[model samples]
Target: MFVESVVRWGAWSILLQFGLGVSAGFCPPRCACRPDTMEVNCSGKHLTSVPESLPSDMKRLDLSQNKLKTLGRRQFLGLTQLQEMDLSDNVISMIEVEAFQGLQNLRILCIKNNRLKIIPVGVFSGLFSLQFLDLSENEILVFLDYTFRDMGNLQLLEAGENDLVFISQRAFTGLQNLQELNLDRSNLTSIPTEALSQLQSLTRLRLLRLTISSLPNNVFRRLHRLRSLLISHWPSLDTLASNSLIGLNLTSLVISRSNLSAVPYSALRHLVYLRYLDLSYNPITSIQGNLLGDLLRLQELHLVGGNLLRIEPGAFRGLTYFRVLNVSSNQLTTLEEGAFHSVGNLQVLRLDGNPLACDCRLLWVVRRRFRLNFDGRQPTCLSPDMVREREFQGFSEKELPRVFICRPSRIIDRRRQEANIEEGTNILFSCKADGDPAPTITWISSQKTLLSPTGRIRVLSDGTLEVRYAQVQDSGMYQCTAGNAAGNDTLSVSLQVKGFPRNRTMPFFTEQGWIESSFPPTANSSAQVANPYPFDAKTLIIATTMGFLSFLSSVAICFVFMFFWSQSKGQIKHTATIDFVPRASMGGGGEGGDTGRFTMKLI
Candidate 1:
């Protein structure tokens, strides 16, 4: 019995010793260890380097916020099963080429917020399965060629907030599976589009806080698979060329806080598949026709902080699928008709913080009540003094036109404003007037006829009369008449064609005191005219005829006024008069009290 009891005690002692040895090997010094899960938390331990005595089977090791200055080779040796490792916020300034040689199965590696100056080539060559690599908040200056060639399976790369000034074309050559790349706050004026072609599989890319003045042509070339792109906070970005985004298949594009004075329609038209577009915080002034027409798939548009002044008709032509549009914090005064006609699917409209001139033109918004979201700050009217301080939704359409009467400017009826141009050159004559209905302009010739757009005469959309290849016959007074429901305004412009003396041979006179010549002088004709007056009798006759027409116009105006007065509802029916003289004092009887008579009028 004594021999059997002693054998049992020896067996129990051997088991206890083996268990203690395994526990000691699993737990590292100055760290928190979970032996069951094989996770070591050595963060903020102020260690000089990675623990050399880490468990070989550990899956997660965190050495963050440490004083490790350099990572030497074989640092993680034997840790082949390390699937996630974090050395963030460490002062690791240098990493040896083979420092992570043994981490074959590592899937996530974060070295952010370090002082890493350089990562030697082939340092990460064996991390074939590393799907997430975060090297942000470091001092990496250059990305040498083939720096990440072996990381073909990397899906997300965060290299932002670094001092990266140069990156080779082959730096990301093998990262074919990369999905997201963040290069925010990097010291790069322009991206190497050729190098970016290697990221054919990239889905999202961010480039914020750059100093690039202009986006070069084909800036996003070959990035057909890119889905989301953000290029914001570039205060110096002024010009975006037409082809800047020629080859992008982006779904969301944000270019806010840039100095864009106008919408890059040519560049934006290429983004046919874009769903969300944010152009906020720009200085754009106007939105014209076909500018946002082709963005049929767009669902939201952000135009806030742009200080936009006008939106022409058909600006939102093809945005049938648009749902949200924000135009707040702008300097808009009024919107034209049919501005939002094509946006049938719009659900939310933001128009706050604008000095909106709510006139009859904008009454359609109130009548329709198209989901205007002012966020409690309503837009006020700037016209029709009775409703000047009224909010957009405060009044009804019945009360709008009463005070929205507009008066045409007096300067519109002035005589011809002379403009001189060389023969065979182009000239544009513009006429503008302000009225409640926004007057439509038309051009009339001297022959009491309306002038239509012909081969050389073109009328622009903004009421500019353009005469291409000006000839001698084109030299005459063009009557530009603007008319609306309120009133009509007329202005005559005379175009003098110079440097074409050959057209002065046969001059035709008009009743409006303007000349139109059609014949060109022959080469044998004398250079100077023999007439002493330089003014012909025909010109005098035309001037006298214009004066007679003016006299007739005055007589007709007087007759019309007298006729209207006769038909007036108010009229004087009877009249009475009274005359009084000064009376004498009551105590003293003056010579004689003067008689008085009173007169009154009644309608």
Candidate 2:
């Protein structure tokens, strides 16, 4: 009975061991002894290769930061149920063709910070369901064509911080569903026009290392759906062409650095929807009149780091909706009297870092806009001569001097002339003057007509008058009258209306080589007017001679007066001294008197 019992027990034990071996294939290599609910964790185990016989029901696999050199075929072939896979921070040099052939359900694939030089063709061809692919911080130099052709469902593609110099056309052809593509800090010099042409669905592109100078025209023409574009570290750009961004729908554009000079009007013409623009780090000298008039939707404008020298009167006329304006780090010498007149909605105005010149015109504007000063900030004088020994640091608006003065311009010259009217000839009549007030101008024609109001003549505010499309009947003496509040002046330039070819020939005289007989002889006459004021030279000679004679007469008179006065005083003193000397001896007194008389004569 005992031997039969022992035999049955030994057979039952053998059956139990066989059943355990069959169930081991269904579980991971490390979880064979644990309960069924225990997780199959194989992370950070100095793993150099994908472990064999992983549980088919495993939900998570963390193979991050492993010294993995390469991934071969059938590595993750059995992980059909796997959802997340982390292969980041590894030495993954290469990926075999079918390495992820069976990971159809994988959602997150993190292979960042690896030694990948080039993504082998079709390496990710089977990952059709992958939503996130992070290949950033790798050694990838060039993206091979069709490398991401099958990843149509990818949402985020991070390929930044790589050795990529150029992006080949159609490299992202199949990634139309991608939403965000980060290529910042890639050291890219130029992006191919067709590189992002296929990514129509991309809404955000961060090109952080894209300097303003390397930005090419029409580079963003196809990115009509882009909303936020970051182009930082671009310092050398000066002008932006109007059509450079023809079709982009950008909302926020940031371009910083200190080398930019001018903010071209055309640069932001098409950015009609732009709400925020940062043009900091430029040396913009002037803002052209009506330049920002069309940017009605601009909310925040940052002109920091630009050494701006002037702001024209109408420069900010159209920016009525601007809220925040920062104009720091500039050389703004003057803010014109009406520089900020039309900007009613401006809230925060930052005028720091500028060597502002505090003068009458500037002070007037500041005083008018005192409410715009947020923190009692003041403008400083940049002129060394204006501020004595102490530098012109900023002062509060209340502390600023109430009165300031300006010097007037000096007078140059005045002249008048007349000419006969000539027919069938275009005549140009002008009266030029130079002054600070930009003289008020008027014109009158021979027909007693006010020529300025006529459409035939166009008068510029700067005192330039243009007579357009003149006819023969328009020939007559034209008078140009200009004046300021201080003084008034008039000049008449005669326009001869005589028939042409009749007086075309000139007469030759003995003294004058050629003379126009039909034209009257004015100050510009060919002979006598050659040297105006003929008596000027003779008058100068006569004045010089008279001055020399007068000087000699004055010196002679002074010498005669001094000689007579000295002789009278000496004779009087000598008589007094002889009288004071008493007669000591008769004979001695006689000798002394003779000597004294001789001495007095000599004196």
Candidate 3:
């Protein structure tokens, strides 16, 4: 009986130990735990502090969106195996020195969107394996020495959107493996370049909307591995010293929306491999040869929405690989010849919203040899009243009059020679001119009749003659006389109408480029026919008959080829069968070889 009691007691103790080990993974109140993954989720709970009874070997802990105010020392003492800890969106104002003491294997720690004001030195003392640390959107004002000295393996440090104004000299002394650093919107006037240069692995840095005014020469030469640098929204930025961007290997540079009256071209001479450059929304006025001389590898350049007025010849001298050039919205009146001579590879050109002068000087743009592709709305003529408001894409030399010359008071009209219309139709004759001052216009006809605004004959505000009804009597030589203080000029136009008058309401031209008459069709033997398109009815009938005959010929040829193809296919099949049978019969039976040979001879 004594031996049995001892055995039962030992068995009961083993059972109790087994039960305790299984219960360790049980879900806690208002919290969850996964035994398979060893993860603990206690997020969105009203817990004032981290729960002490969490699993000791949890790999992930999510304590986000909680009311935790402070992290006491040894709060995570036993969570040595936790790889990721998310304490974001919490009221964590204070973190004791040893708050992350035993988290030697933690790889990611997010304390962003918290109320932390200061990051005490050694706060991240034992997190040797930490790679990413996000303390952004916090109240950290100053960075003290040795604040991040213990995190030697950290790669990314995102402390943007903070109140950081100053950083101690030794604040980043031991962060040798850091790669990316973001300090945007922090109001930092100066950065400790000496300490930052020590980080050899740093490749990307952003200093957006900083308070610094000017950049010294070679300010970023020490950042040897930097590939991207962005400095934007510096409202007071006006000067960039010579060699400011020298001795660096950057691929992208963006300095936009600043107070730069002109680009610091002297400083950008060192960006040899720059592929993307954006300097839009600046107050730059002109582009000269020295501004963007020899950037051979540049691909995209955005200079939209500026005060740019001119682009000197050879402005794009050495940019052979340029793909996009945007210079929209400015007060440009003309361009020198070969302005884009070197940019042969340009794909997109934006030159809209500029007051361009339309004349022989723009023949380069109208020629097919240029082949320029516009990006947005095409430029319209803003001068030489004849072509005013006409898009450059469709303007042609034929639209100019044969004797057209932009004089003080000379009228320009497309129909200066002659015009043809139906007797009962309406027509418009525009006589627009350019002069130093305003010009007055008058109209006269071949029959010595002074034309004025009458029943069916009216003159537009722009001195355009309108004829509502067309009659044989109305068909004659019309002249437009323009007089100004400088001089007086005249332009002649001949109107020819074919057909009898429909009604006798004096025909006048409308602004809609049409002629209207208040007359009924005469439709008598003397009436003439009207042809709207280039070809007459007889020519159209002949073209339609020829097209139908050509189509029938094509179908007939296809049918003939198909008929021959069927006959050829049948002959080939018969020949192939005859050739194949002899070989099979000869190989199968030697005695029947003579029969096969005879058959071949007959074929």
TM-score of each: 0.68, 0.58, 0.57
Per-residue lDDT over 417-476 for candidate 2, one digit per residue giving the tens place of the 0 to 100 score:
544543333445556665433345777777867765435555555444555434455666
lDDT of 1 by residue, 161-229 (tens): 998888888888899999999998978878867778889999999998888899988987888899999
Q: Model 3, range 1-603, lDDT digits (tens) per residue?
A: 999999999885764433222224444556766655677788898878788677777788899999999998768998778999999999999998978999999999999899988999878999899999999998989889889988999999988888988878788878898989888788677656666766778888887777788888767767888888888888888888887788778888888888889978888878888888888878999888645766778887778778888787778766778777777777776654456645457677666777876654455555532367786468677877767887767755676442123237767654446779876677888788777444678888778677777646667777888877676678888888887544788888889987745544544456675454565556674454555789988999999999999999999999999999888766442222233334554437554444332223223
- When sorted by lDDT, best at the front, the candidate numbers are 1, 3, 2
Worst 10 residues of 3 by lDDT: 594-603
TM-score computed on alpha carbons, candidate 1? 0.68
Local accuracy by lDDT, each model: 0.79, 0.67, 0.76
Clashes of each: 7, 10, 14
What is residue 561's positional error in candidate 2, in angstroms? 93
User: Residue 512 in candidate 3 has what lDDT?
Assistant: 71
Candidate 2 — what's its lDDT?
A: 0.67
